[model samples]
Target: MKKTPLFAALLGLFGSVVVPIYAQTVSLQPLWESDTTLRTPESVLYYPAQKALYVACINGRPTAENKGSFIAKVGLDGKVIKLRFTENLNSTKGMGILGDKLYVTEMAQVAEISLSTGKVVNRYSIPEAKFLNDIAIDTRKNIIYVTDMGSNRVWSLTNGKAELVVEGAPLQNPNGLLFDNNQVLIGNGDGSLLAVDPATKNVKTLGKVTGGIDGITALGRQAYMVSEWGGKVWHVRADGTTELKLDTTAEKINSADIDYNSDAKVLYVPTFNHNTVKALSLK
Candidate 1:
């Protein structure tokens, strides 16, 4: 059972090979760019079942008056399939899909659309909601969480009612939400990322402050890729370490809400002002 020099050298080589897989920094490269049919595209949702991309287009400023908003459907090959699949929404932003229904945030309301028929089946209004942004769904619990950046609150919807779950500075204008396991992870507009207990509302900070965050996607079990409204993407590790992955602020590519296909290792980003969805490969 004694250790030999050859064994120690082999172990060292193995460590060197494995450590970089977790610690090495990787950059995203553009795979394909979709057509500019999405007006003020703010969020992208990939439907694996249908093999299509759903984009939430704000169309105008994030206000109720911007009734020109709509959702566009695009193919994975960067082709525009439907420019106005669901039209006449009021400043739609984030989106979440549960079952055959697609949930979207529109100003002070959440609209549920039928994925099969492509129609708005129902709308749930939040009495005090202001600037509802990103959304996440806890499928196991049948709960939907939405962020109201202007109101500094996180709204939860269950059984047909919307209620305020958490509010104030710890939220810091929460924008992106992700339901992982039994917890909800949130990315704030003020550049803070946190994990929250849905039932107790206990928050645990996950990463250091970066730029204004807009979308959050899980990179693996221990890390995430956070997109900022300022056109930057950051990688946040489980231990709260962060690294810049992409920066396009100088080119003015506004990285709004993002979606990821874990199986394909692809990242879909909606460019708010640019009116397009860009696909990048994390590999």
Candidate 2:
């Protein structure tokens, strides 16, 4: 049968709709940024129960013995509630919350804090961990995952016992971690995004090279917002395509460990050296 003009017109219209969906790119709209504080904020974790944000501040060097670090509580409207919500920590970096407990990564140990009283309840020391950078919780499995950047290893804690689970080049100084659907998503310091099967420890590369990825939060199923330590943000799509969303390298505004409010489509970014937490709208 011969191709008719009406058929060709319909085909063209269909192509136009499908192409844009696959080619869609993500962009950020600045919503609100918190006022600069004396605390050198490194990561932001959103608490849905209280609808607030918690920031981990490394007051001085990111070392084991630096005891000047603290955590801050911030409102969604970009107001600092308590600059030092918890104090006397050692170079705290990333955070994860489960139930009434908030888990945070210090130089070589993970601290468990009470959400209600804001007090450190217990500490889990990782003997071989060096520069533990990020934390993720497997709520369903009752497991906690953390990345050790200095050791290029990923550790898992179950029943209060921590063990090195994944290591070597595949992790490549892994810095950011997220547990979704029983899978562990990792962002490396060498700009690579990877997915790992927690049960089998099988690893798969998700996308091409990225910046020195610090924090990672899910945008959708396979989509994620990744923050680079050198002040850049990239939106990684399901098909392994990465789009640059924000850059502040020239200003030296470090986009450190980030968190996302999925329901509100908000991305919370902590500027490590700038001492500020910025909320960007993804709507």
Candidate 3:
């Protein structure tokens, strides 16, 4: 039997990969917009104390001639505040906050920055990783979990050393990661949300999402996910119920992150494709 060219390419990407066996449907909506100034936004982190959302922009492709990545802070009213430039970040994706430290993951390393200066504090390297994308921190356990897109595996890090915690899994192009309570939620590029047990490497299908899942953030009992192709942000309950909280197909929202300001009742969404940020009011 002759293998299709596309199938062959996918096989090279996933190492003896099988095409998607099943797919689930998704519905989405748009909550707000930055209207201007954002280039290839990848993730969003809401800072309630300052009532701002930080947007991480992927300035160039991994192999593109330009070698720069940036982070921008936007107010709820759609005001763009360009934060310090993250000088050498490569193929950047997820962003997480721990106290005053901001952690950003790019390709094979995690870059730690000072929130005040946006200066690179330290760069943590992950060995044996093919393509590292999103990262989730479990403050309760003092551990961090990162997903590898090239290997379809999840790694665990503590005090900076990384070890393969989950291997030979069904994750397809895993991108965003969120650790809440005792579970780790992974968003895959194929449009699926998976619930994983870090201690066991056991996985359960939570729900099917549309578009390519990029970044996810958990607030309260609900987990919010951003889709790169669906161009929307979705809110899903831990129990697997989903709702289209915001739609930005028109704005070209590709890759997104969320920062929830509970007191202010606002949600910050950074659209990568549009190079702008969208602030959504929860009220």
Candidate 4:
């Protein structure tokens, strides 16, 4: 049978449609896991510029007196460059880097540490904040946002003053937060990922998970990777549906406050109680 022009055209059309749909399907491939030196690690931030990772370690309970918290600097190959790169903090959790400063969430205050010296330079506190869980910064406006899981509120800091952004009902003890452009992504305690407009304060449900969402990383347009503290990683698609990609709950390995390097398509997850960080390649 000779290949007809019409059949060839139809085949090319079908191939184009199928390839993109197949390419959209993504999964996690385990790359490497760090040593147990990361005690109670809660968050991992992949710094592309430096080609390294920052792991926030809450050595013990996230309480006011738990001053054993520290941040570890890890190489991209899952090696601990410095086990205690920065030490003597109170229950540090999430972290964000802007310029030469690293901002971290303490139990009740946001600690600003100088990246150059690895020393606490400033503290941003909200008198009523009980538990400050995550930090997200807007580089353009130089504003920092934080989530208070205990008080179920969201806040922003500018010019060294803290102000309420939103709280209560829809908040649901918001845990994970990501500041992406005009909208803020909040991972609620109720397992729903809400996208809130920063200007109008309107919110929209993007997706949901089985448990409280702890970490969120965007993978291009309308695609996201979210994690539950119970050790589940889910991929949220453009249609508001979710697929569980990884589950370590049975193994008791947490996936807390994960970060991704877009250029490398690698996700860096900090395992809280397991005391380690794992890297997974997005395939």
Global lDDT of each model? 0.87, 0.87, 0.70, 0.89
Q: Give model 4's TM-score versus the native structure.
A: 0.93
Per-residue CA lDDT of candidate 4, range 1-283, in tens? 4658886797788863344331367889999999999999999998888899999999999899999999999999999988888899999998998889999999999999988788999998876999999888889988888999999888988877998888888989899989875678999999999988877888899989999999988886767899999999999887788889999999998999999989989988888999989999998
Clashing pairs in 1: none
**Candidate 1: regions farther than 4 A off:** 1-17, 20-22
**TM-score computed on alpha carbons, candidate 2:** 0.92
For residues 53-98, write the lDDT of model 2, one tens digit per residue.
9999998789877998998999999998988888899899989998
- Candidate ranking under TM-score, highest first, comes to 4, 1, 2, 3
Count clashes in each candidate, considering only residues at least 3 apart in sequence or on different chains.
0, 0, 11, 0
Quality of model 2 by C-alpha lDDT: 0.87
TM-score of each: 0.93, 0.92, 0.79, 0.93
**Candidate 4: where are CA atoms >4 Å away?**
1-15, 18-23
Q: Report the C-alpha lDDT of model 1 over 32-69, residue by residue, as the tens digit.
A: 98777788999999889988899999888888798989
Error of 4 at 107 (Å): 0.7
Residue-wise lDDT of candidate 3 within 85-204, one digit each (tens)?
466567676777777777877777888888888888988888877777777888877788888877888887788788887766578878778886588888876778888888777888
